[model samples]
Target: MRLSIISTHKRIQKGDIGEFEKLFRNLYSPLCHYAFRFIKDMDSAEDIVQDLFYNYWKNREKLEITTSLKSYLYQAVRNKCIKTINHQQVKEKYNNVLRLQGQDYDDYSSSNIETEELNQIIESTIDELPDRCKEIFVLSRYEGMKYHEIAQRLSISVKTVEANMGKALKMFRLNLKGYYQISANQ
Candidate 1:
C-alpha cells in the first residue's frame, strides 16, 4: 500500500491527473485541519489549503519534497496563514487611522483629491526605492515574510534583510512625511 501511494504521488508530480486527484483526496482534509490551527477560521483555512494544493499542482515540475508530503502541505498552509494575518493587520491599521480622523469633511471632492494625491505620492516613493530594497520591503511588508524566510528565499543573509528593510522604512518615512506636510499645507 505504501509503495502504491508513493508511486501515485510521483505520478501526480509528473502531471498525471488521476494520481493527482487521489493524492489530493488523501491529503485535503488533513491539510485543512492543519491550516485551521494556525488561522482559527474554518472557511479561510479551507481556502488556504485549496490554494496550496492548486499552487503545488501548478508548480509540480519544480517541486522537491525531502520530508513527508504532509509536512510540506503544513508548511505551505502556515505561510499562507501568516500572510493572511499580516494583511488583516494592515487593514485594521488603516481603518483605525480613518476612525480617529473622523471622516466628517463637508467637501467630499477635496477629500477625494487629497486621497488620490497621497496614493500617487506613496506609489512614486515605492517606485523610487532601490530594486533589491523594494523587493525585500514588499515581500516582508505585503507578503508577511519573516526575516529568516526572506533571507532563505532570496539566498541572502538575515542581516542583509534587516539592513535593507531599515533603509526601505527610512526612505518611505522621509518621503511620506513630506507628502503629508504638503497635503496639510494645501
Candidate 2:
C-alpha cells in the first residue's frame, strides 16, 4: 500500500487521479485524529483534515516533500486547528465580556446590535493597521503562530515581531476605548 501511495503521488504530480480514493481513505482517519487533539471537536477535525487533503490534491504539482506525506498532512491539520481555535477564542472572549457585564440578554435585538458593532470596530481597526503590522498581528493572533514562527515566516527578527505585535495591541486598545467604555457602562 505504501508503494502504491508513492506511485499515486507520482501520478498525482502528473495531474492524474487514479489512486486518489485509496490515498484519501488511507490518510483521512489518522489526520482527523491528529486535528481533533488541537481542535477538540470531531466535526471540525474532520473538516480540517478534508480541507487539507483537498488542498493537497489541488496543489499536488507544486507540493514539495522535504518530509514524509504524513508529516505534511499533519502540519496542515495543525495549522488549520490553530486557526479554528484562535477564532473561537476571539468569539468566546467577546461574548464573555458582554455576559459578565450583565448586559440585557433579554433584549435580543440590542444584544445583536452591540455584538455586530463590536465586531465591526475590531475589523476596521485591523484593516487600518499598517501593512506589516497587520500581517504580523494576524499571523500571531488569528493564526495562533508563535513570535519565532512568525519572524521566521516573515524573515524578520523575533524582536521585530514582538515590537509589531505590541504596536498592534496598542492601536487596538486605543481605537476600541470608546467601545470598551460603552460596554463598561452597560
Candidate 3:
C-alpha cells in the first residue's frame, strides 16, 4: 500500500512490519546508490543502507523525522558514506606510519629495528673501549666538546685527546661498516 511519510512513520512506530517492509523496499536501492556515489564500493554502500534501515526499525519508537522520509534516508546514507571514507583514510595513514616505524623504510628515518640494532652495536662497541678512550670519545662526539676542551676538562694533552678520537673513529668505522652498508642498501 502507498503511504505518506507520516503514515509510514506511524506504522513503523506501531510495529506494523508490512508497511515498514514496503518503505524499506521503496527506499533501500535509492539510498544504496546514493551512498555508492560517495564511497565507490557496492558492498560498503549496501551495508550502509542496510544498517540504516535496521537501526531505523530497531529505534522506530524514538525516531524523529523533521524532513521527508526520502530526505532523511538520503541524508543518513550521505553521512554514513562520508564517515566510511574518512575512516578508510585514517586507516591508510595509520598503516603508512606503521610501515615507516616497522621494517619498511623509504627515505625517511631508518626503521625501528635498524635504528635499535645500530644503537646496540655502537653502545656495545663503545663499552668495549678503554675507560679513558670511551670518556674522551663520548665527550668529543656526544657532548660536542672540541679536542682542546676535552683535554682541558680531562686534564690531558691535546695530543692525547686527538689520539683517543682517532682510535674511537677507527673502532666505529671497522665495527659499523657492515651495518652501515646494509642500511644504505635498504
* lDDT string, candidate 3, 96-129, tens digits: 8868776333333346667789899999889988
lDDT of 2 at 116: 99
- Per residue, candidate 1 scores C-alpha lDDT tens digits across 45-146 of 999988888898998878777766666677788889999999978877766666678753334447888789888877887898899999999999889999
lDDT for each residue of candidate 2 in 1-186, tens digit (9 for 90 to 100): 353336666777787776667678888898888888897889999988888878888989987766666666677888889999999898777767768886534565587888899999989999999999999999988999999999999999999999999999999999899998998998
Q: Each candidate's lDDT (Cα)?
A: 0.82, 0.84, 0.86
Model 3 residue 184 lDDT? Answer: 83
TM-score of 2: 0.50
Indicate which candidate wins on TM-score.
Answer: 3
Q: Could you tell me every candidate's TM-score relative to the true structure?
A: 0.51, 0.50, 0.53
Instruction: Give residue 2's error in model 2 in angstroms.
Output: 3.7
Cand. 1 Cα-lDDT: 0.82
- What are the RMSD figures for all models against the true structure? 19.2, 18.6, 9.4
Which candidate wins on lDDT? 3
lDDT of 2: 0.84
